[model samples]
Target: MSVRAAELPSRDALQQLVRAKAGTAKVHHLVPVHPALAPLLPDGGLRPGAAYSVTGGALLLTLLAEPSAAGSWCGVVGVPELGAEAARSAGVALDRIALVPQPGERWLSVVAALAEVLPVVAVRPAGRVRDADAARLAARLRERSCVLLVCGDWPRVEARLAVDEARWEGLGEGHGYLSGRDVVVSVATRSTATPRHVRLVLPDATGRLSAKAPGTGPVELRAVG
Candidate 1:
C-alpha cells in the first residue's frame, strides 16, 4: 500500500514535534566531544538547549569542536582573549566560527541573537548579568535548542565544568618551550545528574587532547548529590 505525499507531515509539524519533545533526552540532539573529555560529560557529549557554566578560557572554548566539526554554526561573544589560532588547533572549523571580540554592554543581546540561529553559542560575560536577562537568555536557548557555553560565573546554571590543578608537561627547569598541559576536569550538573571527573591532556605533546593512561597519572573524583 503506497501512501500519498499529502499524508506526510510538513516541516513545520516536524519542527513543532521536536520542540515539544526537546526537554526529553530522546528528542534532544547530543553533540560528541573529544573522547578523552567524554567521561566528564553527563551523556558523554554536549546537550543542546541547555546552559553550561565552565571555567578555563581555552578549555571552555575548546568544547565547540564537536559541534563545529559536525557542520554546526558556533558563535563566540565577548571573549577577546580567545584566539582563532587556538580554536583551530582544537579542531574547530574556523569558517563556521562567528566571533564578536568585544560585546561590551550588549553581550547578552548579542548572545540572544546568535542563539536564535547558531547551534552553539559561547560567551564570556564582560560583567554581571541581571537575573531578568539571564532568564530571558535561558528561555531563548531552550526554545531554539541552542547550547549556551558560558566561560565564567553564572548563577543557577544547568551544569558547571571546571578545570583544576593544571600542570604543564614541558618546560621543566626552563629547558624546553611550552608543550602540553594536564588538568583535572570536573563536571557537575543540577538539571541532570552528572557527577564525575577525569584527568586528561588539554593538549598532549603533539597538540592534541587525549586521556592519560591509567595508573600513570593522578586521579580525583568528587562525589556529588
Candidate 2:
C-alpha cells in the first residue's frame, strides 16, 4: 500500500495548505452548513476545488445535495450504492445529477471532463490518484473554479474537511419511520484552519433544514438512550 498523505508533506507545507486566504471580503447573506460555520470559512459557502470526505457513502451524498438543490450540475463518478429516494431527500436535483454507472481506471479523465462543465463534481475514491494526477486536477479546478468533493483519502489534495460521526437519540418505542434511531449528524472539520464542530438536525420529510430543539445558544446533539 502507498503511504498516507499525512506522511509525505512536512508540517510547514501542511500548514501552508491549511491556512485560510488573507484579506477576505465580506459577502452578504452567504449560505453555509450552519451559522457558526459561516464565519470559519473564508468564502462563506462551500469552497470550490476543495474536498470533503465523509465516513461513508450516505454522508458523502448528503454533502453533495446542497449544491445540487441550488440548480447546479453535479457529476457523480464511480458510485453504485446511491439510492434514488435518498438522493431526492438530500435535495439533489435527480435530473441534474448525472450518475456514471461505471467509471473504471478512467477516474482522472472523467473528473477532468466533469470539472469543466459541472458546478459540483463528486467522485467515489477507489484506486490510487497520485500526487502528479492530483496536481493536474487541482490546476484544472483552479482554472474552472468548480467545487470538487471526493469521498476518500487524498494526500495530494491541498485542503480537506472530515465530518465526524453523528450521535442520535430521542426515539420512543418504535416511533417514527426510521429504526428508532435519531441520528444527530455533525458538521465538523476545517480545510484551512482548526477543525470546527457543530450540530445539524436532519431535514424533515419535506426536505427542510431545521434544528430539533430550538434555542439561541450553541447547538448540541441529542439522541435516544
Candidate 3:
C-alpha cells in the first residue's frame, strides 16, 4: 500500500479507522526478530508497543523480516531509498508491506497513523524531531500495540542497535564480487549499563542474516555511548 502525503489522515481519524479494522485487541506478546539478533535484545524479540532506534537500513530491514514473515503487516515511512528488492531479499514479505516513501513534514503523523494498524513500522526522520512529538507518538504506539523502528535518532527508545564494525566478504584479491557482510551489532537498552555485542553475517550468502561461525575470527567489541 502507498500513502501519499497529500492524502494522509489525521491521527484521530487514523486511530478510528484502525479501531474499525482491527478492533480493540491489544497485542501483549513480543514480535519475533531474526534468531541471530535475538540475543542482543533483552526480551529476546521486539516488545509490542515499543520504539527502537536502529543505526543501519539493512539492520532495520532485518528487524522487520521475521515479523513480516510471521504474517504481520509492516510499513515503511519517509524512506524513499528503501529498495523493495532488497527488502524481499532480506526476507521481508513484500506483499504485506506498505511504503510511504515521502511523508514530508508530516512524517511523524504518518508514522503514528501506520503504527495504529501495522504491527511493525519503520521510519527515517526527514528532519529533527521534538521530544514532545516523540512522546505523543509513544503513547499512540502503546495504545495500538505497534512496534516502531526508527532509522535515525529518537528522543526516547527502548533499545538502540548499531553496527559498530563491518567488513564485506567475497572480495578476494579484487577478483570476486562482494557477497556478504560481517558486522558487529551492538545493542543498548535502558536495563543494561553496557551494550551487548554480537557478530553475524548481516546478509549472508543467501541474503539472510545469520550468526557468524565459531572460531571464524576474534570479534572486536567496543562500547557504544
What tens digits encode model 2's per-residue C-alpha lDDT throughout 1-51? 888976798988767666634213212212234443345345666666555
Better of 1 and 2 by TM-score: 1
How many residue pairs collide in each prediction? 0, 5, 0
Residue 162 of model 1 has an lDDT of: 86
Greater lDDT among 1 and 2 belongs to 1
Model 1 per-residue lDDT tens digits across residues 1-225:
999999999999999888777546534487667777776776667777778888886676578887888899999998877867777887789999999998888888999999999988999888988888888888898788888999887776767888887887556453566667878888888755655788878876655566865223333346979
Candidate 3 wrongly placed segments (more than 4 Å): 1-28, 214-225
lDDT of each: 0.79, 0.61, 0.86
Error of 2 at 102 (Å): 1.3
Candidate number achieving the greatest lDDT relative to the actual structure = 3
TM-scores for the candidates: 0.80, 0.67, 0.81
Off by over 4 Å in 1: 1-28, 191-195, 214-225
What pairs collide in candidate 2?
A: 168-223, 169-223, 169-224, 170-223, 170-224
**Stretch of 10 with least lDDT, candidate 2:** 22-31
